[model samples]
Target: MATLRQTITNALLMTAVVSMATPVTAQDCATPGQWLTPGNQHAEAQPPMGWDRLARQRVVLLGEQHDQAAHHRWQLSTITALHSRQADMAIGLEMLPRKVQPALDQWVAGELDESQLLDRTQWYRYWGRDAERYLPILRFARDHRLPLIALNVTPEQRRELSDPASHQWTLDQRHGVPVPLAASARYRQRLMESFEQHSSEQLSSHISEAFIRAQLVWDSSMAAALANASHQHSLVVAILGLGHVQYADGVPHQLTRYGISDVTGLMPMAAADACLAPTGVADALFIAEPDAPSADTPRLGINVERTPQPLGPDRLVITAISPDSPAQYAGLEEGDQVVAIAGHEVRDTAQVRALMARSLPGSLIPVEVLRAGERRQQLVTLPSPSP
Candidate 1:
């Protein structure tokens, strides 16, 4: 059996050489000339031209990298272009969950402003600052009165599904609920494999497991949302991460499994590259290149120095401390500043993580912290490796 690392390497290699041989039809909108603006700095200069053809299909999945501002801008532009062409519904967002679904629905119904719609913590948890990128899509959805579906798994449900032992039980519960069989099986198997491969005693097993479970929940949620929207609208658009939207095994693949076969997946090409390629069930794919940065921006964060920086008012601050984690067990709290680790001065988040990674599980590491302007030292023993 191939190892997970080997599998990933092979997949990436295959992705590199697989040329999209099918010629885009004239009616198909794979060309860049249709959607992209010339010399547009805010938007991609050469956006995937053929999305109009893809948009005509039953479902159009737009894959995007999360932090790429250009990709988000292009996504908004694509939605606008499709709407102008009379597309009806937009479904399956990775960021919005059922808990906040009502807010999204309200926004689409023009009952709430875009800011008011997504301002809740429940909607912003996984999104962070990247939520700003979706502003345009939110505006479009609200302006057009198009139905916006919330397609994300809730936190509690995600935790339940990530455990391999709970798979059968979860399946039994969600059965007959329009959940795609193939998609669920694939997710459970992949998540189990990922857990076994990446997990060890040193790190929190539940943390990693929860992350994977969240993905499975997100997938199932998106599928359900898509099925419902297809019944109400002819052309449904799904905006999600490139990973969730790419490959034959993603949301589109699950849609095909459920017998919803008509779909197209569009992804923006890196500015350095051209030519769009088909992903799994997608009949059409388009690529676009955005503009380059005006000047080189130096990357931030710590520089590796054997000696740590002096503990001062600018000491490294703790943004979060996982519950039941070593930091938490040691009584570390958010807003605490790390003055020293294992008697060595610590400078930043990177250094703190590095120190933790190097320490063996069960070893006691002395941590000096400043909490509420009071200096305190504590000895924290790392937990056993998580299965």
Candidate 2:
């Protein structure tokens, strides 16, 4: 019997990244005409000539850091620019799992409001990392009547993919596309680095294998979804993490397994985890400056519900504590009235937002909440993902 790794390698070699002119070599990808501007810098400036070439391609990918507000800004700018050029396109989002496609459809069709859409998609639970960052782009899609495709695996599917005992091979091979591929030496090294940062445990070979498989599931699923949605020569603007769109080895490479060929990958030049090896980041780069995050950035790390008929803008009540979140560690409880955060009096959601904008994740927060009509003060430790 073939080993799982052998099976994966064989499936990958069979579909080698493309049937196009050729797999874009390291040197061939970053031609003068392919490099684009940064997300923050592109707002006031005209897109470079390279963008024109990319816009003409079958699929264009814009990579971002999920919590980076400016990346979403740049994505919207690029999408609107392409639309202005009369390009027929649809946007794919990694935030929404495929199960929420109906919510996406309803949102774009103007049948659902923001709160309702987020609720219907289980946004806070499944995608609770942060939705505010992408809200503007979602609104943009709805306002422009653009198609939005939910390009992600459901939580259940994620579990299935991560479990070595789960039989996903047959399903993965169902459409003759293999989700697992040979990890490039660079990719493997980077994966280990990321793993080490978040885990105190040793990076055992078996643990590493499971982690890589999970990553493959995300990459391959998005690639397949984009390929299916691109029928009729429509352009696809994929908004996803920089990691998945950085190297051609991610979604772009997965696309070639279906023989779809034409793909242009671009990443924000400001990404912290940029693939520095000549060809790893993307086909080209989008230049953008990082935005200075506000103090009221809401790093208190709790999902909040506004108190009914609030006394002020900061009169928010805690609804839930995100597991492993700072709020959870701070002993915040449901129905706790958020009276102050970081010593700032917040009477409502807006005030809380303002206060959080001024704070950074991992910063010490002195929070005072009215729980059971008694005031309690707690210190919160924000969990910020490393840039």
Candidate 3:
């Protein structure tokens, strides 16, 4: 009944209203549950391309930023997906030393419960990260009766290899680990850059060599473990730090020397990184939405490193303090030795973190710092850590 001009105007008005009401989709790379190639190319044509590639590989490495809950979630989901297709799969973990293999075996065999397994593995002593973040993966392996492989060397072995003196040791004295393959030039350069970023300028200059060797030893040990596991299982999935998986230069490099070439590496990228094109960091990157900040997670906001002294004990030194943090508010400064936290004597940064994890939000904990030969105690109010 309306004129042609009026009908056309109404249709245009409706189209504009509908478009406005519809949600604007996020960029494809940033979209949750999507997979992007190492070159940041969309793999939408084959939704299962990532999974198919993983299924065909002998080893799959899933990397994570230790503190990011979202990274861990992606790892579990990927593991779950791979496991559904590969029942003969095994999981290799960098969280536990080879000394705890018995514990892992017992855990999967239903001989030990969660707490008992942690105790036997000395979880708090070696791995100080939140155990809850990794427990779900362990539980999955247990429920499915999959073998959990311990892929890390003992801390003592790591320390021995980190020293320049270990370079002279024979095969027998090297704790059964072979001499590591020479690092690629790119790998060495990346390690140097990382060392500078994490260490103080003075510490960086003096300890760079040792630090680089330590990382190499870590990579070599894990690769050896994975190689051994690969021979026994249809597939092996390795969960480790992102540094070891990125660019395939860390563990992947060592794996090749161990005769493992069918390896794929995957990592989770934050949505904020969606705009940047990737470059061979991993085989595929999953876009993970950042987790909502937790109000209950206590944060002290300080960077610390344990320096082994020739004397009584290792000193836990504050290397940097975040601005407006509890450490800064409580007058803690760089070079201040953290003698105690929550009234307990602390020997390493791990112990400090363990002690802090016990406190709740709004709790006032006492911290003792020795500054220039003077011991001072301050009460610090804990706050939620930034997401």
Candidate 4:
């Protein structure tokens, strides 16, 4: 079986990180256009040549590298520009799942403040990336009274779809998510290359098939949400991770299946990759300098959620762990229930963040976890702070 990091990297390979090209080899992707600007330095001063093209589309997707504050800023600026010409618009978010959409609606209706929305949505529990980076965009939507549409399926839904055995469920039982259209031959080959990039065998057909199924489930779910929301609003602008928008193979392809064809995808390209961008990566690209790591908060590079225990209060279970992270290096795997950190019991992600933030780099923090009903202990060595 492929590791979680390998799976994630395979998914990300189709994202804006590599311009969603065929493969990473230098020979596969074509060179980027020289006429386009590279970074956000001049973004406010002047819009790109095809800026109006985005406003004309019924749906415009703005892609981002989830952790990059600069990408968010670019998205905000692009959104501000699009809203000027188009008054009737709704913003779709991939961050919050459909279940928490009521919270989003309440936020837009002026019934909730920032803290209230965060609490109601369980923002930290669901989307553990820095909420501060996304608050500005959320505030913009709220202030303008723009309809905020949740464009993602629940984690539970994704888990069900990942299991091939669960194919017995009908469309109604699958929460109305259609059976994903078969992936294009080209798209499948690209995904196959992604799996190979993760040090897996070059011909791992089973892993590729599973990975493609997972990707299809996500793309189709979000596409269905956006397609339905687009009918009510003149324009729907979706803020999603680059992977979903890249090369128009993911969500875009799925959207066409839903009869929503007038769409555009705008991806933010790092300045360093300006010349390396592949053709047709996105409808538009904004050059932005990459953001530096956060100095204020230390990271364990793990996403966790609180799980109700039949016998105990609640357990913090690791949902995902980033590749090459301190947690991964320490042998922490997903499904491990975090018991304690630094001798302090951890009940929530916020507490874990607080404890991790206070510890200096290189400090060996003792961690206790429960794996498969067995208690295990590990010490995580934090990497030195980014220079």
Candidate 4 on 254-307: residue-level lDDT in tens? Answer: 999878889988777654454456567676566676666546556788899989
Off by over 4 Å in 3: 1-28, 43-48, 168-172, 203-206, 296-387
Report the C-alpha lDDT of model 1 over 1-387, residue by residue, as the tens digit: 134323332222122122223353323223443332212212333333454565666777887655566777777877777777755666557666666777777777877754456444244343433345677777777777787777665545544554465555644464322333344454444444544444343335555444444454556667767877788887888887665654546677567655787766666553223332332323323344444543221111222222333653346676666665667677777776678878766554444554554567667778888777699998787665554
Local lDDT at 340 for model 3: 81
Write one digit per residue (lDDT tens) for candidate 2, span 117-137: 876776654554456678888
Evaluate candidate 1 by giving its C-alpha RMSD to the native, one decimal.
13.0
Model 2 TM-score relative to the real fold: 0.66
lDDT of each: 0.56, 0.66, 0.75, 0.76
Instruction: Enumerate residue pairs that collide in model 4.
Output: 15-243, 38-287, 39-287
The positional error of residue 85 in candidate 2, measured at the CA in angstroms, is 2.1
Worst 10 residues of 3 by lDDT: 11-20
lDDT score for residue 86 of model 3: 86
Question: By TM-score, how accurate is candidate 1?
Answer: 0.56
Prediction 3 TM-score vs. true: 0.71
> What shift in Å separates residue 134 of candidate 2 from its native position after superposition?
1.0
What TM-score do all the candidates reach, one by one?
Answer: 0.56, 0.66, 0.71, 0.71
Given candidate 1, what's the lDDT at residue 232?
A: 80
Candidate 1: segments with Cα more than 4 A from true spot: 1-53, 164-214, 271-285, 290-387
